[model samples]
Structure formats: structure tokens, C-alpha cells
Target: MIDRDTVRHVARLSRLRLSDEEQETMREELSGILEHIEHIQSLDLDDVPITTHVVEVENVLGEDVPHEELSVEEALREAPEVAGGGFSVPRMG
Candidate 1:
């Protein structure tokens, strides 16, 4: 829970200018945020498994196919500039 003075102090540290009414409002809002965090902390999670992904996801089956490899000339044809059989760009200097 935050009081008006604490809110005002925080506002000063953050370079924020708030009216008296805004100070009171911020106090209430901060208090509510703390209360909500406390509520979340009250939950029991003893039996829950730690999961990195949200859903029960799996790699969908796909054909084991190989793609045709592109030749150097075919690959370099799309570049705006090329030199010495390689794609070229502007000099860093």
C-alpha cells in the first residue's frame, strides 16, 4: 500500500508533476496493484508442472523431402551487385 506522500516522492524521482487529486488517485492505484500481486501469490501450485510452452504442442507430420540446391550463378543473379563470383555490398569505410 502506498500513501500520498510516497506517491509524491515516487513522482518526484520519476520527474512527474501531479496534482493533489492525482496523488491520491495514484496512491489508490498503487495499493490496488500490490493487493492484486498479493492475491496471485496466495494461489497454490504444488501439483503444477513447469512448462516452457503454453499449449500441448508437437511437430506436425510432414513429408521427408529434399529441396533442389541452387547453383552459384542462379543464386547470385538476384543480388544488386556482384564481384569475384560473390555478392558485393558498399565498402564500410
Candidate 2:
């Protein structure tokens, strides 16, 4: 069980300025959370497989298939800058 002193110490370590009422509330909540965790720890999980999610997810992706190729002119039709028969821009060092 989370005591008042433990709650105050935790709050101080976390740089929190909790009031007396808030500290009492936090103490009860933390104690409840620990109790729940203890109950969960007592459960039998040997038959359950560890998973990231409850539902099974798969990558339902389609096969990559190439289509008709685009010509240089068609490709550079809407380009802002054009160079020597290709897309051009600022020079890189």
C-alpha cells in the first residue's frame, strides 16, 4: 500500500507541489494500481503467447507490377526547372 509519506516523497522526487488532499488521493490511487498489478502477476499466463496487439495483423500488400514507362518529355512536363534534357536545380557542393 502507498502510504502518505511515500506519496509525499514520490511527489517531491517528481518536483510536484501536491496539496494534502491531492496527496491522500494519489496515495489511494497508487495503492489501488499496485494491488491490481499484484492480482495480474498471480494470473496464469503460461499458455498465452506474448503479442504486441490482441488482434493478428498482416501486411495485405499487392505484388509490385511495372506499368507503361513515361518518356523524358512527359516526365519533365510540369517541372519548375529543366536542365540539359533532364530535371535541373541548384548545384550541390
Candidate 3:
């Protein structure tokens, strides 16, 4: 269990200043957190396989084919502004 002194030490290392009430509260909260972690640590997991996610998933189907090449003129035909046969935009600062 974490005590007020330990909590104060932690707060000092973290560059925090806690009041007496806050220190007591943090000590209790941290003790509870440690107890919960200890409980989780006591669980048996020898037969359990490690996994990244809890649920299994499958890949979704995508488009069957890829895009074909387009002619330069066809590609630039819809451009709002063109200079030297290439798409152009305003200069930015």
C-alpha cells in the first residue's frame, strides 16, 4: 500500500505540489490501483495464448482491378489553371 510519504515523494519527483487532503486521497487511490494490479497478476494465464486484440476479424473484399494510365492531356483537361502545359497554383508565403 502507498502511504502519504510515498505519494508526496512521487509528487515531488513529478514536479507537483499536493495539499494534505490531496496527498491522502492520492495515497488511497494509488493503493487501490496497486491492489487491482496485484489481483490481475494473480490470474492463471499459462494456457492462454497472447493476442493483440480480444476479437478476431477478417479482411473485407476490395475493388477487383487497378486504375489504368491516363494521357497527359486527359489528366490536365479539368485543371482550373495550367502553365507550360502543367497544372499551376498560386505561390504561398
Candidate 4:
């Protein structure tokens, strides 16, 4: 999400002086735009053969039969946050 500070920075670069209300509005709009772009970029289109139209793209995926390999306490059971044995998030300022 775009922050208020980012909105202010953009306004400054564009040589604009926005009111607080306008800044908040721009923040929401720009955040939405960026989020939409990110969602598009995250789509898995590897199976879609670069067509100009949209229809019949199939990859149905299901053929990797390798099982039984979760030993770290059954992969941290139902971890919401496991520390040293993997997966523990929240540290990005």
C-alpha cells in the first residue's frame, strides 16, 4: 500500500501542493493502482502461450509423486510462527 509520505513525495516531485484530504485520496488511489499491477504481475501465465486473445489455456498440474518428507516436528505442525526450524515472519521496516 502506498503511504502518505509517498503521496507527499510524488506531489512534491510533480510540483503540486495538495491539501491533507487530497493527499489521503491520492494515497488510496495510488495504492490501489499499484496493488492491481502487482496482482497482474503475480499471475501464473506460463501455460498461456502468449496469445492476443483469451481462451483454452490448460496446465492442470498434478504429477509429482514424491511423499513423506516433513520431519521438523511435522513441519512445525500448524505453525502460526515457528522460529529456528523455519517460517517466522515480521521484520521488514
Task: Give per-residue CA lDDT, model 1, range 22-86, as digits (tens).
Answer: 99988999999898788767779888887888888897997789977898999999999999999
The candidate maximizing lDDT is 2
lDDT of each: 0.89, 0.90, 0.89, 0.88
> How high is the lDDT of residue 55 in model 1?
88
Worst 10 residues of 1 by lDDT: 36-45
Q: Which stretches of candidate 1 lie over 4 Å from their true place?
A: 39-93
Candidate 4 local lDDT, 9-89, one digit each (tens): 989999899999999999998888898789778789988776664777776897799887779998888989898888899
- Candidate 2 residue lDDT tens string, 1-93: 889999989998998999999999999999998997897788899999888877888968977998778988999999999988898888885
- Who is ahead in TM-score, 3 or 4? 3
Worst 10 residues of 2 by lDDT: 54-63
Where is the poorest 10-residue window by lDDT in model 3? 53-62
lDDT tens string, model 3, 1-93?
Answer: 997779989999998989999999899999998987897687899998889877788877978897777988998999999888899999974
RMSD per candidate (Å) reads 11.9, 13.5, 13.1, 13.3
Q: Which residue pairs does candidate 1 place in steric collision? A: none
How far out, in Å, is residue 22 in model 3?
0.1
TM-score of every candidate relative to the true structure: 0.41, 0.43, 0.43, 0.42
